[model samples]
Target: MPSLHAIIPAGGAGTRLWPVSRAGHPKFLLDLTGSGRSLLQQTYDRLVPLVGTAGVNVITGARHRDAVVAQLPDLPGDQVVAEPAPRDSMPAIGLMAALIRRRDPDALVASFAADHLIRGEDRFQDAVRQAADVAREGFVTTIGLRPTSPSTAYGYIEAGDALTAAPDAATVLRFVEKPEVDLAREYLRAGTFRWNAGMFVSRADVMLDHLRREQPRLHAGIEEIAAAWGDSDRDAVLERTWPTLTKIAIDHALAEPVAAAGGVAMVRADFGWSDIGDFAAVSGAVHAGETDLGIVGDPRDVAAIDSSGIVVTSGRAVSLLGVDDIVVVDTPDALLVTTRARAQQVKELVDHWRDAGREDLL
Candidate 1:
């Protein structure tokens, strides 16, 4: 197998997980799993075995650059690429691919989001290895997680024929957006669909070629920035060219088009994974007692009396009584009180705060 480099795109405000996941400290920087390590640190831990410490790179916003570096001190300074502004995953991952190709054209690059959680490390590694192997065959490969439920929250990937070079891999037919509940159930029954976890692997050159063909202007800008990556002009070039590039996601810019052209592959991943997009997922992953009550912060600070819900405390002690299926997140500046079913709408609260001119709470 060729050498692999991992790119972790550590953007996204995680508005659904507000209060605890703020602009200054996003979901990726929080220890939502209660495992003593933040989500980004866990992601780094999972990738280090496959790509080594120096082989892993992180692309984040300029504001979060210091936090990302502080969390991953072992990562090289040059490996932490900070974007002056958010341009979505396409520009972030594309820049990383260009930089990796600058070092070694044949290097295999894999992009993983910074806030996802995966169980069964061995299975995750196996899936990534298979994806990398398929990538070496000059195909853009993604890890298609086996859907455990008809989840309307996640996008689906339709698998087509099996690859001759990689029997464990399947040609991607198309990428589907998050469907309605009824359609999601139908997809679950079909068994040919897998949840698109946004994990992608490809040769750096192959990825760049697809970008050049599909998004010429974006590709050109990244190429120019990559050329001056190690030089003194890096900052100046990135500042001037980045904002001029189109703001789009990698899935729209490369993955969807590449899949339609029969150039994308999928590796079936049977391991457990969660993007941890909201408090509901956090509740499922972390629990305080035998009940469904999930406590993210110190459990000792919480007192539950027949309450079965999620409770996150900052410093003060919280008492929950006779409340079922509720979510209470307490921080020094803000406190969130809602239910798991309404977790997806937490972003509205962030918007409301913004409109209310309470930027400090956000």
Candidate 2:
């Protein structure tokens, strides 16, 4: 019956849904799920019932402090933890684990991304509660969603006999990187495979133990950062040393080693969820006032016509003809027009634009 801590990593700058999701506005801030709440807000809201106000923590970038604060006003401002810069998830997770350790070393921390949409909160919460119960018993756990497609975008977790029944637990059999289409399909057919939900739960001490066993070097650095954690002049300490921490990902630094150590376990999730990685997915869920936004082509646009899959948005003057599967975002300063399938590659396009010195468009 120890207290539970929830760590939500909101530092990712989702570049795929560009123009709409730029440097200052990542995809997580968008009302993509049309849930009336943003993805980050949804993430924050989802935990309120489970953890209470005192148990949740949101870890985001210093750049996004205002956005997060404004989005989740219900949560206390002190609950929000901001990173000095983008150092990837590992450092962010490591830092939070250390800070939380100072407060309660044996506390069970449930960590997840801030930008995912889930259709079943009850199931998700059920799975999290189950995981927390296991964490209380000293297990490092992650919730893995059942995959409906062979998505190359996600890293897959192969949980052999893990959690086959009620309150079940087993060791991780393999950690598979994003694979080729053929192999992904093969994994889908294999009952043991599960999509990495980017969700994890464990005691801070367990994670520190993981760092010591699998990634000692990163662990030592993280411990140093923890020892240095204080608010006497937190800004000064964070600014001076935050950049020194390595930028490796948590999966690379910790999950891989945990899997290697045969202690990693996953719970099969029954929630309906999506990453909402692009505008196409975002547009599918927006509600543009009801009557003011006319349905021009595609029905999902909140207003689209014969354009079955075309996402078009604008005032009364906007129109589309003979177009399908194109994402047309109409903002005053910038417009994003691209095929929905290629949306994932837009980050590379952003790099290209930056490399070409087109900061205006960026």
Candidate 3:
């Protein structure tokens, strides 16, 4: 029953979902679900009940400012926190704490990733409420998704002992990085494993306290940034300081630390959530029944050429021949031709192209 705010990290370029999704346009902004609303906008709408129009804060890169503003126009333009350099999740987490602390020091924050998909809104909102309560009690609450498959694509969390509220909720024994196929299968069979959905609920004051105690350098940098908070010349401050910040993730800098210290709690979320992290994940959402045209194409103009599998088009000419079990995505400037099984590796391909200095291809 306290003041709540939502901090959304919307800085991903979604290189894995390339061709249709590019550096200029990431996966979160696309209505890949064909739900008439984009992922980020959908998240914003869901968080509005707690964060409201003005209370929602988004941390993003300066390059994506116009795109973010275009979606959340009801929000004050200044509320958008744009990083000058490429700092990792730790800095972004720090940035949100600093900014939100200035406005409401005691505010509880419900942090979310912009690109995730969740069905069953009632269950999702209920889980958030429970997490918020735990945060008010000064515990960092993270949602642990019940793994439906032995997916090596996601990191796994071993459910620990039971809690008062969450009898089924795991204590989050240890955070595992992406595992091998065999280990992932082993975990699925073990039945106590859950995927870390990267959602965090905590108070600005409490998280700042933990960061100061645990990550001193990051704490100092963010503290300085917060002290220099509301000046009109914001771009000047970011350009001077953000590049000096470290490139650590919040999971490494904060969550893992708290997890190691044995103070974090996991809430069981059965809301049918998917990270929608790559092209394959998107395909799973858009692909329909085989006999039903099963593929979603621009009705105005879709002339299939012996294509059996699902092919989605956005008003472009798609000529598919003998393509099956494949998701062919055509964007304004790029194209992604990949099988469903290999969709998770889209980020790796993006990185490969980036390493090759093929930014245009990205």
Candidate 4:
């Protein structure tokens, strides 16, 4: 296999997992899985095998640059590209692609989010290898997770004809948004849809060419910034030009349109994966081996009596009695109490805090 560079885009507040996940310390920086490593660290660990530490690059917001760097000390300082502000995934990944092309024009770049959990490392690596092989053939490839259930929480990618060049690869027919419960069930029964895990792979030049044709202004701005990347005027050019660039996701800016024009491919990923988007997912992962309750903090700090829910404590002891399917997160400043069913709506609490002028809690 040819040399493949990995780009990790790590920028999200993870408001749904508030109290523990705040603006200054987001989900990617937290050890939500009790594995002694942060989500970003785990992401780096997974990619280091495919592409050596030198081939991996991380793009994050300027505010969290220090934290990201501190967590991944082995990564080269220059590889951590800090954006002046958040312009979503497109600008972040595009900037990394431009920089990679500058260094090696024939480089194959694979972009993955920094906040996700995956079991079965061997399978994951195999899927990425296949995706890279497909991408080298000039197709924008994405790793599509095999749907295990009728999940309404994730978007779906419909697979079309199988590719002759790479048998494991398929033509991506379309990218569908999150559908209703019944529609999700229908999609599950169809056997042609896969969960959109947001894993994209493509050659740096091919990606840049698509961006130039699809989003001309964004393409031009990133090119200008990439041209001045190694020069002393890089910061000056970025500060003046970044804010003026379009703020859109890679899905809308590149993937969807490219798929419609027959330039997208999919690789079936049969490994266990979770974006950990909410407390429900956290609870499930933490309690996968447990009998009833899930405890995130120190186990000795929690005492459960007739309770079967998730409990996260800071320094204080938390006691629960007769509670079922509940979520309790206790931090030094804020505490969250809700049921697992409403875990997806925890972002509303963050919005409420903002409205009530309680920025400190957030």
Candidate 5:
């Protein structure tokens, strides 16, 4: 097997998890699961065991570079590639792919999101190993999580024929967008559909080849940046060319088109996974469907008489009286009080604050 490298894209503000997940402190930096480690730290913990610290690289925003390094001090300073601005996943992943190619063209690289939470590390590692095997055979491989429910929140992957190189891996027929409840149910019944967790693995050269074919201009920009990566003019080239690249995601720029050409593959994943996209998801992960109130901060600071929702407390004491399904997030500067049903709309609140000139709350 070829030496595998890991690329972790650690962008996104996670506005829906606002009050707790702010622009400065994104969701990736938060410990939503009550676990001691932040999501980014946990992501590093799992991948380091597979690829080692040196093999893992993180592509995050320029603003977050310091925080990301602070969270994972063992990661080499040069390994954290900070983006000049947010252009979405395509540029970040592509730039890292280009960089890895420069280091070793034959290197197998896997991209994973830093904000996602996963359980069953053994199964996850096994799936990555299978995906790597499939990638060696020239297929752009992704680990497709077996859907436990008809989730309308996530995109779906339609698995096609099984690969001969790795029977557990299958060709991806198509990528499906997030569907309505009825359509999601239909996909669930199909059984061929898997949740697209945005996990992709491929030879570094192969990934660049696909990008060069599908997005010539974007490919050129990253290649130029990669050429000057270790040079004194690296920052100059990055700032000059980064913004010119297309603002798109890897799914549209490469995965979808590549799959249409019969070049994409998927490894069936049984491990537990969640993006923790919204406060509702955080509640679900933290509460685990239990009716009791879920506390993310100091439990001693909370006094609930008959509450049945999640509360992320700051330093102050939060007392909930006879409320059900209500979310109370008490930060020092801002307080969010909403029902769990309205958790997804928290982003709207963030936007409202932004528009209202209350940037401090955001």
Candidate 6:
């Protein structure tokens, strides 16, 4: 696994989790799970064990560079690649791929989000190892989480025939968008669909080649920036050219198109996984207290009597009575109260505040 390096693109604002997750301190930086380690640190922890600190590179916004560096000590400073602006996942990942290609053409790169949570460490490592094996075979491989339910919140990966080289790895037929509940249930019943976890493994040259073919303009810009990455003029090149790169995710820029051409592979994963996109998800992902409530702060600070849901408090006592499936987030500047069912709509609330010119709350 010496040839393996992990890249984490950590730039999302996690607006759906506003107040707790602000633009200044995004979701990846906060300890959403009460594990003391931030999500980014947890992501780092997961990958660092597979590839040492030097082998893990972080691609984050310029604003978060220092914090990311602070969270994970002993990692080479240069490995914390900062972006001038958010051009989406494609450019962030593509830049790392280009950089890795320059250093080790044969290196295998695995991309995982900074905010995702995964359980069952051994199963995750096994899936990654298998995905890496499939990647070395020239396939743009992805780890597809086995569907636990008819979850419309996530996109689906359609697994096709199994590859002979790696029996546990299957040829990906296509990538499906987040479907309606009915369609999701159909996919669940088929058993051939897995939640698209957006985790990918591929050889550095292979990934760049796919990028070069599908998104030549974006690829060229990325290459230009990467060429100057090691030089003093790196900032000038990045500032000038990063804005010109296309704003697209890797799924559209690489995964879907590659999968359509029968060049994508899927490794089944059963490890408990969650992106924790909203408060509803947060309620489920966090460890429940004895009262069966998800508390992000001190459990003693929160008192619940025959109530449920999550309460993220900021050093204030929170009490719940006869409330069910509720979400109460208390911050110094603002507070959020909503139900788990309406959690996905929290981003809309953030937008409302933004439109109202309440940047302080954001």
Q: State residue 273's C-alpha deviation in candidate 6, in Å.
A: 0.4
**1-362 per-residue lDDT for model 2 (tens digits):** 67788898897777887766777788778765435688898888888888987888888988898889899887888788888888888878877888888888668888888998777789989989888876666667878888888878778998867453337455577678888999999999987788887888888898888878766766776777677666565667677777887788878877877777776777777687777776555544454344223232344445345554434443424555656666666655766667767767778878888999988767
User: What lDDT does model 3 reach?
Assistant: 0.78
- Alpha-carbon RMSD to native, per candidate: 1.1, 3.5, 2.4, 1.0, 1.3, 1.1
Cα lDDT tens digits for candidate 4, 1-362 = 55799999999999999989999999999999788999999999999999999989999999999999999999999999999999999999999999999999899999999999998999999999899999999999998999888887899999999986565899999999989999999999999999999999999999999999999999999999999998999999999999988999999999999999999999987899988888888887785345478889889998888787688888799999899888999999899999988998999999999999998988
* Model 6 per-residue lDDT tens digits across residues 1-362: 43999999999999999879999999999989788889999899999888888889999999999999999887889999999999999999999989988998789999999999889989999999999999999999999999898987899999999987565899999999999999999999999999999999999899999999999999999999999988999999999999999999999999999999999998988999998888888888887857668999888898899988999988999999999989999998899999998998899999999999998888
TM-score of 3: 0.92
Local accuracy of candidate 3 as per-residue lDDT tens digits, 1-362: 66888888886767677766777787778887778888999888888876688778888878887898998888898778887766877788788877788878788887899888888888888888888777787878788888988888799877788776544454667788889999999999998888889998888888888898888887887877877776765666667777887788878878888888876778888788888877667766664655323355564455555454446577777776666667777666656677877777767767877899988887
Instruction: Mark the 10 consecutive residues where model 6 has the least summed lDDT.
Output: 284-293
Candidate 2's TM-score reads 0.90
Stretch of 10 with least lDDT, candidate 5? 283-292
TM-score list, all predictions = 0.98, 0.90, 0.92, 0.98, 0.97, 0.98
Displacement of the residue 103 alpha carbon in candidate 3, Å: 2.3
Q: Where does candidate 6 clash, by residue pair?
A: none
Model 6, position 343: C-alpha lDDT score: 91
Residue-by-residue lDDT tens digits, candidate 1, 24-92: 888999999789999999999999999899899999999999999999999988899899999999999
Error of 3 at 306 (Å): 7.3
**What value does the lDDT take at residue 360 in candidate 6?**
86
CA deviation > 4 Å runs, candidate 5: 287-290
Cα lDDT of all candidates, in order? 0.92, 0.75, 0.78, 0.92, 0.92, 0.93
Clashes of each: 0, 7, 2, 0, 0, 0
